[model samples]
Target: MSQGGTSIPDEEWERFLREAEAGSAGAPQEPSARARMVTRRLREQPGPPEGWRTYRPARRRRGKGWYVLGLAAAVALLVVALVPGLLVGWFGGGDGADAPRAAGETQRPDGPPAQEAAGRLPTPDRPFSGSPAAGWADGTAGIHLPAARATGWMSRSEVEQALDRTRDFLAASSLDRAVLRGERPSGAMALIDPHQSDVHEFIEKAFRAPDRENDPLLLFSRFRPSDVRPAGDVVRTRGRISFREGERDAVEVSTDVTYVYPVVRAEAGSEEVVRTVVRREVVLSWNDPAKDRVEPGTFSLVSYKVDATNGGCDNTYTGYFTPVFGAERAATGAGDGAVVDPYDRSTPIGERMREAGDAGGGTATRS
Candidate 1:
């Protein structure tokens, strides 16, 4: 049978020849070896005249030297085009099948990076629970007592010592010349909880800002022992301590502190001292089986917050003072220039607080 422009089957051609021979002889003829040989020779002959041809199979044209050379060149070009990409993928450059990645683009194990997948703060292992006993309030300037009795995790004396140590450390660090010069205070990490990345970032930024002099924390260095009325009253500090139970054998001790300091400034070319009152609420977490253990009386500072600020100082300036401790404001200009808010809420401390309230009372954290 014909297929497209090709010839009929070999079986059909053989049958036709047998039928013609039988009809001519008037009987089935067993063809002689000579006749069969002649028939095979005719089938083998190339390009017979169209009218005379009975059976002819299509032939494949043999390529010339140039044709073979052209084919070889095309194959070489194809291999050259693919080898680089194949090598790149095999050597871990990237998925070579896809477009090459741009510089600085992070290669992910699968899909997009974690931050891009969902624009939200990371969920804490154990989020803060419960609220501060007293909603944000002013802590008086005196020896305020603890609101709740100490639990087994932390004793009354241990809590008292922790508070005292924290207060003293803050005071000492504020006046430390090394810290003013952008050097981290010694033993500073001991007071901070290693697991609290936010607190650590806040501390680093407060001390390590490129412009050391303009750093907000440097404002504390301006205070001299003689600035306050009483020699030892340079720091008018007061705090109230409280405690609550937390997950994983931990105790949350909240210390509401108020620090009133004198910020001496030159206004209208005249010397004037501004009494900046900074109120802050600090939460210290004490865990029995902490990853980083301290001396018997010490506790880790998990978190802290600036509850409120008043006494004519801008909230931005006062806020930083409590949490870490600005902005550049002209010494003589009143309300003419703005103070730069040094506290970067995008930092780790701000990020952590966004996920959970400072006092642990809010159900939803700010992402």
Candidate 2:
């Protein structure tokens, strides 16, 4: 019939009413979506993706015709007596706030509450459910490599090798289950320049009998085997790796990455969970070992620092992280200093590093 100068075909009108009544919706993807960058990137960006408008067809849009059709549909609807179910579906007349919730959903906000209130419980299945790390890439996938370019002193291949070695070092030190569970970080240690005997010896000594002065946790993320264990196999990570030419024809590679470890009490049937954020900043130097006895692909550890937040302030010099949970934090404060956000990656690693339970490991706090 002709209404609002736009004809509403009998078949199209009927189909529209039926679809509205049924409340049609497409099926949701299964297994849930993986988070790309758990940080600000996850938020809705300001505009459409690059070249979005350029690729669109240049066809003219049918503007007010859609509005006229809507008006005609409304007139037709007013004339026809509507059923209760159709009315309810058409205008959302169901329970406003009294509807039963889904099996696992709650009425609270998206993420965990601020530290002022009681800590939130992370779902057992998705340990990162209420955490920012939920959107972050899983494991080493988060550590992406930039296009390898030759520096003044280093060849393209050399720079590429440096990036790989640095990435491997990060994966071995932070994400390895054996190392996290208090085993030796031999893989990570092996990546160090073998010719740097002092550095190698220091790591060996730290592992054998770490004290307040010689702690290995500065470079490796570890948890006390008897105290805490990972909630799942995944460890969310995000960061950047870059390289530049330093003095004396040495290629300097710098890595700044944050690792989020979801851990739970080691006790059987413990449901409580806590996350420990470790931000490590490592500087490695590679020089032409034409005459020296350094390993071909090895890097000399120029310097390394770490910031371990959301952990116990009273870490025993036992060479393992003592993360704080809700119960424990209630009895003993998470820390005395300012509250630290475990997910903040904006700040540099040096500014974040603190002397939290310094194991005689000299003041990591930089001026």
Candidate 3:
């Protein structure tokens, strides 16, 4: 097959080993079955839709200097053939092969290049210098190369302000929004905003059973920011979420956020040193006390508290919610037996929730 005046095989699998080895460093592990099929289809054709591109393996080429050397070698071979005395002298250990002797003289016991042709040395650790997936056109559009690691020190106030801006943004905005926009403000306003009920609905839908319909109404009775403290070059805020019991098929409404900002050193001729904010986020096990109830009628507002912690200090917050659910597992026993006890689940939930914010928590679910 002719592609850009170069011959390409009709079947990729036929030369898969060679191509894969050549591209081992620059591409992701081989795609899975569905992805492979999609790639194969696109490879057989040409352009794809706007958002997608046809799979094209990256090609590596020798440098122009090496090409020139190759041409020179070919010309030298021609000259040597015309002059038989040179080849005979080279085999007979004459000065004509002095360059090869000098090259062999540089060989070492454990050196990588010594094992191969000196001019075609293998890579040390990885093969390619850059990966197509990690290039500018990839998702990291505005990311500048990380500046040199900071020396000197950052002030406590500077760290606080950076932490505050990131915290406020995460608390107020959705993570999807924050990641897309590449910024978040420092405050719990986002977490406390009345407009965030859709977030709970989205969480519920994520866990609902195929046979069961979910109409989750999350009422955040209390949302508060307890404290903020400087830790290294970042500031951590501890908070809580509490609500009344309400109708939820399988709701997972937990929130944890971390923000990282660059520590700028005082410079002579720099306007603003932009610090990249890296957020460490967490989503605790959902607290569902008002689950499948016996009565289809209204239920009292049960409290659900998220004891979120940072480091060793625990910050607790409670809220009230009244959920309504259709009659399905209305039987007095729905959950996995005594594990359904309110106090039992509540105690462990609080303790583990605190641990979740500190050390990542264990997995538990109410089905």
Say which candidate scores most in lDDT. Answer: 2
Ranking by TM-score: 2, 1, 3
Give the alpha carbon lDDT tens digit for every residue of 1-367 in model 2. 6778999999987786565445455322111000011111112322111110000010000000000000000001111122322211111122111111112111212433223223434644556655556555556555656778887456787677667667777877777766777778777776666666555665777789876435677677788868987675577666677778764566777777767777788898988766666667677776655433456556666665555554434325567667666655555422233334545556553343332222111211100
lDDT per residue as tens, model 1, 105-154: 11111221112223321111111001110111111213244433566455
Every model's TM-score? 0.37, 0.62, 0.17
List clashing residue pairs in candidate 1: 131-361, 198-348, 198-349, 320-325, 327-340, 354-366
lDDT per model, in order?
0.30, 0.51, 0.19
Q: Which 10 residues in a row give candidate 2 its minimum summed lDDT?
A: 65-74
Give one digit per residue, the lDDT tens place, for model 3 in 1-367.
5668987675854465455445545333211000011111222332221110010001000000000000000000111011222111111111111111111111111311112223321121211111111111111111111112211122334222322222222333322222112221112222222222332333234224211112111111111112111111211111222111112422222222212221122233322222111112222111122433221111111122221111110111111011111231132122111111110111333333333242222211110
- Between candidates 1 and 2, the one scoring higher on lDDT is 2
Clashes of each: 6, 2, 26
TM-score of 1: 0.37
Candidate 3 TM-score to native? 0.17
Candidate 3 clash figure, as a count: 26
If ranked by lDDT, best first, what sequence of candidates would result?
A: 2, 1, 3
